[model samples]
Target: MNYLHWLSPDVDLSGDKAKVPTSGASFVKYFQPSPPASDPPHRYTFLLYAQPADFKMPKLASPLAFDLVSFAKAAGIGEPKAGTFMQVQG
Candidate 1:
């Protein structure tokens, strides 16, 4: 499941490292990772999808049931341009 989601079209992608867009971005969902319950812990994934200027974000009732495939189908966004994951235990 996704722990956080943010979108920003104004962000400059040419930099050596990630930086906030000059126009700023909006968070579809806040970052909230639950305490790991397993020995291996739970994996949290971050995805960076290229949002078109005409892209319309679908209204989600709950993030709990959020599915990437379903979301892409609804939002009409293409495959993720970048992504990463991590397992956190606390």
Candidate 2:
């Protein structure tokens, strides 16, 4: 099964990694289209991948700056199986 880390724009995952849930290598979150006042709508995207038989979470300095393609290659997740996005207005 694949393991996923759900991230939010305002929520910090650095100290709350333990609270994140694990699924079939995928963790999904609701899309919040609305940003704070004076801010622009953020693009929320989902990146799906095929998890390897044996997988482990790699140490990341900043999860927010994570590169999807690079992570997939390092984790042996292969290319994204599917993807989608939504826009929220501030």
Kindly list the per-residue Cα lDDT of model 1 for residues 1-90, writing each as its tens digit. Answer: 543344444445777987655554564624566675655677777777777789876877666656778888888878988889877775
lDDT for position 78 in model 2: 75
1-88, model 2: which lDDT tens digit per residue? 1223363222223484423343333233443344677877666776545556586655555544557666666667677665797666
- Candidates' lDDT values, in order? 0.66, 0.52
Off by over 4 Å in 1: 1-11, 21-25, 36-40
* lDDT score at residue 8, model 1, on the 0-100 scale: 47
Off by over 4 Å in 2: 1-34
In candidate 1, position 13 carries an lDDT of 70
User: Native-vs-model 2 lDDT?
Assistant: 0.52
